[model samples]
Target: MKKPKTTNRYCKFCKKRTSQKLAAVKTGTPSSLKRGSKYRMRKRGLNRGFGNKGKTSRGALGSWKRYGVKGSKKISLKYTCGDCKKVGLSANTIRSKKLQFE
Candidate 1:
């Protein structure tokens, strides 16, 4: 879907309608040093020598292709208020295969 680069929207910070810049909010990257990742590494026997690490040792139960996946993702919009210079996120989310800012 295509959207305008800027639009007039109600800004909570400004307490009035203002010209806002539109941008797509992207998902951030996960850090491998996190606790969950560390535990997964240990279970997968990627850390040290192991005899039998059980079911999780194989990592995933099946190939990624076997699991049903969604073609699109829920994307939210970020609005930068022209008056207050504060950032705000849209309450509603849009599900689309591709989002373009025009």
Candidate 2:
């Protein structure tokens, strides 16, 4: 696999990107882990429920849409400041500053 490109940019929260590093991300565990062993052994929907196809239901297109959700949920990796080690600023802020300097 190819590596992602990095540019000479300032991390406002960190104040600079000189010492930043890529942080490892982890995957979420299955919901079944929360149940007891006995419960896990019993097949789900064995009695009252229909088979997987008809039993499972989902909303139509745009049915689950919500408004005013914050941007933090959409971003995974954040730029950690090399100077102060803080991590919450918009990426556009960095880009605008770079353009101004150039």
The candidate that wins on lDDT is: 1
| Model 2 regions more than 4 Å off | 4-8, 14-17, 24-48, 54-77, 88-102
Candidate 1 residue pairs in backbone clash: none
* TM-scores, all models, native as reference: 0.68, 0.29
- Quality of model 1 by C-alpha lDDT: 0.76
Model 1 agreement with the true structure over 1-102: per-residue lDDT tens digits: 999999999998888999999999978855565544535545556556754344344535324323346788789999999888899999999999999888
Residue 49's lDDT in candidate 2: 64
- lDDT computed for candidate 2: 0.37
lDDT of each: 0.76, 0.37
Model 2: per-residue Cα lDDT over 1-102, one tens digit each: 122332344766545445543332233544463343323323453554654333223322123333233333332334445556655433432211111111
